[model samples]
Target: MRSRAGLVAVCGAMLAAAVALPLGGTAYAADTAGATDAARTAAADTPSALVLTLSPGESAQTVGVERAVTLTCTPSPGGSHPAPQEACAELSAADGDLAALPAQPQSFCAMIYAPVVVTVQGAWQGERVDYARSFPNECVMRAQGGPLYAF
Candidate 1:
C-alpha cells in the first residue's frame, strides 16, 4: 500500500511539473505589445513628406526638391520581401540658399513574399532633415495578383 501511494505521488509531481513548466516561462505578449505601440507612435510622429504611388507596371519615382532631406522607407508587414527600385533627383537650390540637397536617392525592389525598407539622409539649409516611408509589395501581390496587380 505504501509503495502504491509513493507511486501516485511521483506521478502527480511529474504531472504538475509538466503543466507548470511552460507557463512559468516569460510571456512575449508584453514585449510584443510594447514594440507594436512604439512602432505605431514612431510612424505617426514621422509623416512622409512626399508620397509616391507606383502602379504595378510602374517601378519608380523622381522627387524634385531644393534642399537635401533624409528619406527612410519601411514596408508594411515586414522587410522580408523585395521592394520597388527608387531613384533620387539631384538637388538644385539657388545660390546662397541655406537648404541642402540629398546626395543620393533611396532605392529598393519589390518581391513576391519579401518586403523591404530604404533610407537616405542629407542636409537642407544647413539644418538636418529626415524623411521616412514604407512599401509592402508582397502583401499587395498576395491580396491582388496580376501584371497590373503584381507588386
Candidate 2:
C-alpha cells in the first residue's frame, strides 16, 4: 500500500536523523572541548555528596577515619575518591542498597574485637541515605562494607 510505503520512508528518515544527531553531537563536542571543560568542571563540582567516617565505636564520637567525597553519577560517574569508578560501580551494583553490599567471607576475618564504627551519610541515586553501623573491628568493617566504605 502507499501508506505502508510512506510509513517506511518516514521511519527511515527518523532513524537517519537519530543516528546523525549523535554523530553531530560528537563533532560539536570535538569543536567545543575547551569551552565545554569549564561547564563540565562546574557540573563535576556540583555536589552529589557523601560523608563516611570510621570511629572506634558508637559511643566514642571522634572519627578515626573520615572521607568527604562528592560523587557525580550522571553522564558518567566521577569524584574525589581514590577509586571513583570502582566505588560508583559498586554502589550501582548494589542499587544504592548499602545493606546489600556483600560481606567478605568469614575465612578472611580474624577473631579480633576492637569495636569499630562505620557511618555513611549522603545522597545516593537522588535518595538521602544515613546509615551507621558498628562492627567488631576494622577487619569486620572491611569484610562487610566493601569498597564504598573502605576509605
Candidate 3:
C-alpha cells in the first residue's frame, strides 16, 4: 500500500508538469531565418517532428470546397497536403513561423469582400503553435499566405 501511494504521487506530478508546459512555452516565432536552428535541429534529430492542420476554414463549407489537410514535416513530410514537400520545406525555412512565410503576391485580385479565415494549429519541435488570420478574400489570402494555404 505504501508503494502504491508513492506511485500515485509520482504520476500526479508528471501530469501537472505536462499541463503547465504550454503556459510557459514560447511561440517559436523567428526574429531571423536562423532563429529556429534549435527547433530545426531537434526536428532533424527526432524524426516526424511536425504535424499541423492546414486549413482554409469554415467559409469553405459554405462554398462546398474545403482545402484542409494534415501536414507532417520530417521523416519525409507527407500527409493530405497536395505539395507536402514544398509546404514542409517552406515551413522549415520560416522556422515554423506561419506569419513569417514568404509572400507570393497574386498579380491581380478582384476587389471582393469574401473573408476567409485561415489557421495552422499544431506542434513544432515539442512547442505548441496556434495561429489564425482573416483575409479579405481568397486571392488576398493566397497573396499573403503563399503555399501554406495554396491547396
Q: 1-151, model 1: which lDDT tens digit per residue?
A: 9999999999999999889867855665666788988876665444322222233222223343312222222221111113321321122122112123222233333555433222233433233434333336535432322111122
lDDT by residue for model 3 over 1-151, one digit each (tens)? 9999999999999999899877756543334447567656766655434333333444433443244677777667787777788887888888778888888744578998877777666766566777767777788777876666776
Best by TM-score: 3
Model 3 is weakest, by summed lDDT over 10 consecutive residues, at 48-57
Q: Which stretches of candidate 1 lie over 4 Å from their true place?
A: 1-26, 51-151
Q: Which candidate comes out best when scored by lDDT?
A: 2
Position 60, candidate 1: lDDT: 26
**lDDT score, candidate 3, position 85:** 84
TM-score result, candidate 3 = 0.60
TM-score of 1: 0.20
Sliding window of 10 residues with minimal summed lDDT for model 1: 89-98
For candidate 2, the clash count comes to 0
lDDT of candidate 2 over 1-151, digit per residue (tens):
9999999999999999998998799788787997778765664454555666667765436555544555555546666656667777777788677888887565387788888777778776456878878888887777787777666
Of candidates 2 and 1, the better by TM-score = 2
Question: Which candidate order results from sorting by TM-score in descending order?
Answer: 3, 2, 1
Q: What lDDT score goes with residue 86 in model 1? A: 32
The true-versus-predicted C-alpha distance at residue 44 of model 1, in Å, is 0.8
